[model samples]
Target chain A: MTKYKINLILALVFHLKLISQNFNFDSDIKISEEFRYFFNDPSFQGQEDFFPSYSLTPKFNIKFNDNNIIFRGFFRHDKDIRRTHVDLREFYYQTSISQYDFSIGYHQVFWGVVESNNLVDIINQNDAVESPFGNDKLGQPLSKFTYSSKNTGIFSFFLMPFHRKIVFPGKKARFRFPVVLNRNFIKYEKNNKKLKKDFAFRWNHYFDIVDIGLSYFNGNGREPIFNRNTFMAFYPMISQFGLDLQLTFETFLFKFEGIKRTADLQSFYAQVVGLEYTLNNVNGNGLDIGMISEYSYDDRGALAVNSLQNDVFIGTRFNWNDFSGTSLLVGLLSDIKYNSQSFSCDFSRRFKEVYKINLEFQYFLNIDSRELLLPFFINDHFFKIELSQFF
Target chain B: MKKIIVILLLIQTLNLFSQSNEKLGFEIAQKAVLMDQGFKSLSTKLKMTLKNRNGQTSERLLENKILEQVEDGDFSLIIFNTPKDVKGTATLTYTHKIGPDDQWLFLPAVNRVKRISSSNKSGPFMGSEFSFEDLASAELEKYSYKFIAEKDEFKIVEAYPVDEKSGYSKRVVYYNSKKNYRVEKVEFYDRKGDHLKTLRYEKFNLYKEKFWRADVFIMKNHQTNKETVLEFSDWNFDVNFSRDDFTQEALKKAGN
Candidate 1:
């Protein structure tokens, strides 16, 4: 405790010294209006056939010498539950001196190589309410230390003293589970709570055409087990080892991500491997076309909580490489063990410099009972459109 | 015997003249590259304006950092500044004189740095008339050259890219022979050996009393009737950039 107090005093003095110096600052804001229309009525009575919402994200940054402080926030207003919430996307102070760097605050870190699904990226929880596609992330509060080796690789250590619990979408949400898990019935291990200390270490390097990363995380697992009948969720303590690799050769990129974990509830292994290849100037035009194929596997197969167990993903991407930055991606994900298939299309373009338009479509051709909420998603096929303005 | 000797002498003179032209062309290219050495590092911002056939225009802004490697190739990083949706995106490239370059792109929204194929760099950059190949540092060994002509203050050279994957079949370059051998104009021929585009460099800046860099580049495509103008600013040679700043770890912070 005495040492901790001394460190704090020293850090305070350091900050005070920089406080008198000149600082450069800048800020940006993004406002987006989103509307989603479901082709069919939601299976649940409380859900809606269409959902509309808006979000605002504001970011501010300040820098002096090699030190930087950044703050970013996300706020959304929706007619549905769970969708209307505020999140701290990032609030951190970072500085780099020579071969070492340090940062401490709430942040988001993504760690994976495969595009279809990520099994090794466990640093941030999914902001499910923001997007059912699972790209939105909730910031994690942690302290990070990074060191670059002269001839080896980069090493990073993270200390997370608190866990941000995942929130389930409210009953009125379009893609909500049949029943919402009651907080009163949720279960946690004896020492499990928000204060659970988590630690993670990762080492990554680029060797010519190949890049590889290895990581170890010891703490509560980010993905929880659902007690379907009990209408509850359980958090388990687990240790996970992850590896991600990518090889770029010619016009092709090969990717792989895998993780093995030992948990109080159960132990399992999961992996995802994929490749993307681009054909530039396909027909003497500026347009470029690409293809992506990935395979995901889990030890628990259909029983896995993650929707991608034993699944194959195929996607096609078209890039106009034009002035307006128009791009489109159409993908299909299917589970071999359960025979579930989901097709999606994403399109985005920029216009008028500061504005962008995005469109997305999701359709479920079939859903196996083993896929959990996917069966109810047949009625959730929807089209979404978003317009964003940046300043 | 006298007539035969005269013919032999004439042939010998022609052969020597052709050989000298080739040798002079290569020598001028070497001089151009050598004069810019020892700058160590450079940082600049580029404002790119693209004009379509319809006479409409769009603009993009990006910042660039280049680290010169004495023995190998230069490492360059470009961070996009504007065109709104692409703001905060960054791309890094390691270019070699003889082979394909290595490239990586950083997407700020996801905070992900992904390695991308560099072979496709021959495509247009930001839908502009300039392709990635057009913007790369002119390495002496990447092309084979022959002297075309010397008119007034400039000497012209015709060159062919050694990497067959290049978008152009040939290029005619004109350099100001009186001043630092700086490139003045270039004409590019497409893969079909048809005239494609022409680039003109104007308004040169001399930095550190040794390096001469062009402040403006205008490229016009004949077939597409498209034009692109690039203006460079904020030229800084001493930001203390190191190899460490070019790594994947540093790419994550490039947006900031």
Candidate 2:
């Protein structure tokens, strides 16, 4: 074992001894099931009319003394015209010490992004078309260590070394393992009037709202450019600098974030900026409205072979507490240059605890006429219904 | 004919207006309480993964059963899969959901079941980072609530725990107005009634047109400075279970 591991083990042993004398150990379990259906447009070719997906996820958690641990595993089975069987989704362990904490195994790590639209998140496994861009691969191991200094500030470092596999339909893909690292440091000032207490170095604040970060990676996971003979070379060295800012005045909440990524070549640099604002109470009935927007620019100050892509989105939500508590949400996304549009709506109703029901609808428009643009603009409609009971 | 049609339209409009007055928050809390009352027994499969400080990981799987009777607040039996240390372990609680949810654990290694006091409920469950409070069914009636605001799609409410010994003193809940029974966000308060954590629910789905469940639940604890994100899928409810399944003999027979 490494020195760090030895130290950790010793500390754990000491703590466990103390806990066994004063506290007791306990355990719990949770089980869940999910069913999904997908309908594709027949005109799109090689599309299926109905695709059903099911998953069973069981979770177990335990605690001793002041220390706690969690473990969860996910299994997915899909029945479409093509595939059927159980696929392992995720398995990981997480634990914490005084000011230090760690997680390892097949886990998901989310960092620096508005809805995970930025480049910092690497463990995203969402397959929904509405989800932001991210990669999900198995066999990737991630570790994160964090420290806090009470009233001063907080800092954390995250590292991951793993093999990334990219498989295309009907073809064997490529695989590469690389080392990735991310570091974040944040400081807060006292705002007694707005907050109950002055800003202090704490894990919850530091991990949830990272103010400053530096990220870098070295890997050879580039997609093959020409039939496994040629590969597109990405700058082996990439670094990003970013910050998150929040402003709260009266009942209004405003948030702004920006991130910049630099590569060896000027053309490969990327920058993203995002802003959101929510106004409380428009009319009576407690109606509030909010707007969110983000913009990304790539290939700045460098020669580029393709045109720059821009994306913009806006949405609003309305809630009514009366009438058994009902909620409604609608959002729209538009690719200005490509003239593509996506719209979604969600509605829910809670009847006295016996049952609750929710419905969602989404539509994606395919506007690209060129075959090259089809990959990014496959239009489709999606719908889902969910019901749950408390017992 | 025209006069009758106009009268019927007026009555329908009146009914809609009356229905709109019932707040979403109130409905959700009411439903939450009802759901907690319907269960007589439960059976589930559990998988646990442990990650040590050194990054080594291990996983284990087991089956669980619980038999409950609410009239006397008696937990007849709780059983676990058979294993040398764990098999045939059954617990019977004389009084649960009262002052202290009394519990007992029967360990095959000792050939006896041990009583668990109220103080022990705060301990971790298994080797995971969850506590007994997290495992227990939250009683909606245990808290009093006030409607705070109605946003574009949800009604936000604040609930104050009536039980002094409850883990949290206060909570803020956001409910979907259209569905009138879904929770979007829940903010938990510490013993001092200070905001300590926030739990957000997303990806709501309607199952069997009777229930609405969130696919993801992210809990951020402020006091301890930790976060737990639960992404749940494949939810099957109403599976048949019996009191015999929760017996110690059955647990031992199953082999933990």
Candidate 3:
């Protein structure tokens, strides 16, 4: 059975574990200034159209005698009081002994192969105050052990003793619903406590043209369902099995990610599948353009926490192949059932050696009647411009 | 009578060498490859400067780690060090002998690794005159060659790329026969066999008393009037590197 195969591989990983020694030290810092503007007036009371913010991120690393210590910090000052905060993104120590590596502290890792939405990535909780799309995550505190086999695959195990809850935008924020949720009212299904320990395992392998990963996770669900009347969030306990795969050949790349979960309340699945084809040297020029199309499906339907359920995404990415590393990505998502639509455009360019300018625009139109995603209270369309200096 | 005898011997050797020009070219290339083999592993830092037609220049800094595979092509990892905007960004490449190479790009901000298709070799690399195909053609088996000419210390050979995706139709290499067959210069011809670019290798250093590496490389684009100067420094071969150091898991750790 599959369980036997997994057990056998786990045993082999512990037995066939190798040696490396090196020393390196590095440091990096970035300061970013940003301005954001909203398209429409506030749908709620005491909301503003323009806001400004600044942030500083610093990272320091040291590697000595096969052991590495890494530290990263994020601090921000924003006009919105809810967005102003300080966080330790990473502070970890990892060491290698032969083929085995062990690490402990706050860390972050991403899973899944889809470009539009990643349903299989469930390790970290969303920092919705920073980005509603869940592109940003708070660092997780955990301990991990990995066994890497030369010819077979890579096996990894994680143990997390604490859980971080989602942080939503406050009442004055543009994306907030008409009714504000009280954080103190949040409840957990398992003994009404957030200290539940979680565990995960993953097996990743590469075979010439394809790369695949199989993972299992038993943890507190990162997504929560809310009670409309009392404005309370209930976190559920979930057991999930996930698969992510990618096949790359010539100029074509195919990616697929799927996850099946059984929670304390219900059972459901979600999937993202897509293909990307790159056309290099277009018209004898150095410009490279990639065409992408993907579909997202979620069995949770009305209860889904993301807007990508039952939606189709079409996108184009352009790389000018210039010295500045200029790139532009534009995409549109259209709902199949509700006929709602959303568009996003991101453009970034580096200049003057260590400085970069980024522009982002996002718009939502024809919201679903049930409001599966953004709330109906605020005009969520916005554009943001950022100038960053790195040292 | 002795001079006449020496002249005859020299003429006889030259005739024998020219009998099969293709075979002679192959032998010269194979010998060079063999001379540079058995390096085991290498690590170095690289500084690249790009000069535009208007006389402006920009610089990029990166570190390179190479693991020599006996049967397949080498496995290389490139980590960007400066232009701090891209710091901690790394790329892993597993070049093969038969199929296309496997390449991945690691993004540090998101902690994500994306497998990218390596079929677009002809496109320019970071706006530099050198294309990805140009950087990949250093292997002896990637091209077929023919002897063009032989002079005092230089042996000229014409090499045709084996990959259909190559941007150049032919490349002419001038090897320094006196310096263990080290390449001194190369001239590239475009798809129409038009003169495209010229590259010169300078300041060669002998490493491990067996391998010859050029410290300075200058590539000039004839059509675009642009140039790139690549400098290699701090070559370290004493450190140990394992195959496990180049995998996706390692990339994530390295990104951090």
Candidate 4:
């Protein structure tokens, strides 16, 4: 342990030396505490978790003449399933030369327009233990080269080396499926050596009122197929093609995202189409309300996880446009084939200059037995509040 | 008969003078827009303080970079630098002279760029007293100018929004009558013709002896009794920027 600590300090010093060579440097640190109140008791024993969790993240950025570097790290200690862990969210060196931009190291890429599901955002693995909603992702290591044109479109290519696997909540956690995911017993459809070298490409352009993107990816699938009891996680070799489109009119936004993936076990297609319409300054009170609706469909029937075979999502976002920076979003997702449904609400407000407060609540209702992973999360509905201070 | 003829001639002269005055108002507005052009690019740091009716205050820091389009409206980027929650957020706007502007917002938390279709341009900017329309670079064709009055050293001009979608009925702009022709103040009237807001430009500093910029701008909303003060500093007009710097892909990296 002493040697490990010494080595860690040495590595940090080396990184500091590399950063000091830059011209201008800026850094920010944030600390947050989250408290969750579970209205429902854990269905099983030993599942009762602590009420509070803590997280600390420090971000650093440096600019060297024409080159830029940014690094962010996250460290969290929780009483529930994840326990304690540290992750490197982003550490990349980027530069733009002429019409091309390049970045090498750990990074994240977000693609697609549909709000309900991001079918084309498959470059990074999900950090499921961070949030039950699956909106968090682990950092991915890749070398990216992008070309942007004034009149045409932007094309980006990524050569990714190494794959990060998704982690699930432990048995002692709440709001998770009953099956305990064993990270050790992972399976790969192809040899690890071959799967390590993955490639992805995307082209995005805007024409008049419409914005569109086409993406192609060949890599180990981000989602793992799990079997019962042993939690046999299988990372299959897959190839995917994706299309995302958005059309913005006067006060309405139309969006669509679709993907076709071929894997070792099954070939499936999925799509989500949505629209958002805003009523600005309703009643002349500086309140803007946006209504959103989306429909999701997957061809893989009940075989797919999360019961996303067919679903409809409806949500509303309200912006007070006040000095407090108040905003609220409420959404609901219902399974078309089953009676399972999920309702969530997120409200946030900025306090003064350095602090922000957020309240989030999610409830899963009427879980049909036919829905996959429903049995374990029967008592996972809860409300959480968090405060973050930035320095 | 001689007296009547003299009166008719007087009326004719008055009519011609009024017509010329209207033409002069348009010419002055056009001249102001033209004089401020050819700067090529400008980058500045801004600090905005928003105060409500109850005197509660909040502040946000932003960095703005503008690249002048040779033939069209300007392309600009605004990056939020302070106010912890909003830090790392940025917005890119491409303003057009003939039509509505294109705007995209980058949210750091989600790491996604959202295309906002806000053609109305009347929404408050970041909950401040200033509206989105006010933040955009002024274009001469957007409004029709009519000479209102001359108060001391300032020439007041009334500008009517030509676009039917404008939330305001008209705007009254005050310009410095001097050769510099910089804006001095502005007053906005709502759709119902009520006085909505008043903006005052203070502490003018001439850069390179040709370009004029205000060091302080204060916008006061009449209806809500709220005010926003924008203080600008660290103006750099020579830092060269290209079209590549204004793309949506560059927004995420703009925090640096």
Candidate 3 residues lying further than 4 Å off, grouped into runs, are: A1-24, A227-232, A283-285, A375-378, B1-19
Winner on lDDT between 1 and 3 is: 1
Ranking of all predicted structures according to TM-score, beginning with the best and ending with the worst: 1, 4, 3, 2
> Best to worst by lDDT, what's the order?
1, 4, 3, 2
Measured by lDDT, the strongest candidate is 1
**C-alpha lDDT of residue A136 in model 1:** 90
Residue pairs in clash, model 1: none
- Candidate 4 chain A, which ten residues in sequence have the lowest lDDT sum? A176-185
lDDT of 3 by residue, A1-391 (tens): 9999999998776544411234577888999999989989988887778889999999999887778999988888887777787777888999989778999998877887888898888888877778777488889998999988657778999999988876656666777766565554566778854457999999888889898989999978887866555655787888999999999988999999999999867789889999999999885658899999999999988667786679999999999888898999999988898868888999999999889999999887767776555556337789999999998
Residue range B1-256, candidate 1, lDDT tens digits = 9999999999999999988888988887888788878888889999999998999888888999998886767888899989867778998887887777878899888888788888875788888898878888778888888898999999898888888778989999998878888899999999899999999999998888878889999999999899999999999998767888787777777786
lDDT per residue, candidate 4, B1-256, as tens digits? 9999999999999989877877888988988888898898899999999998999888889999999986888999999987877789999888888887888888887688888885746778888988878888888888987887888888988888887767689999998969578998999999999999999999989998898899999999988899999999999999798887788787767854
Model 4, runs deviating above 4 Å: A1-22, A81-83, A227-231, B1-21
Per-residue lDDT for B129-234 in model 3, tens only?
8788776626777889888899999999988888888888999999888888888899999999999999999999998888899999899999889999989999
TM-scores for the candidates: 0.93, 0.45, 0.91, 0.92
Q: Highest TM-score: which candidate?
A: 1
Interface RMSD of each: 1.6, 20.6, 1.5, 1.6
| Comparison by TM-score, 1 against 4, better one | 1
Instruction: Give the DockQ (2 decimals) of all models.
Output: 0.60, 0.02, 0.53, 0.62
**Better structure of 1 and 3 per TM-score:** 1
Residue A91 Cα positional deviation in candidate 2, in Å, after optimal superposition: 4.4
**Residue range with the least summed lDDT across 10 consecutive positions in model 2 chain A:** A170-179
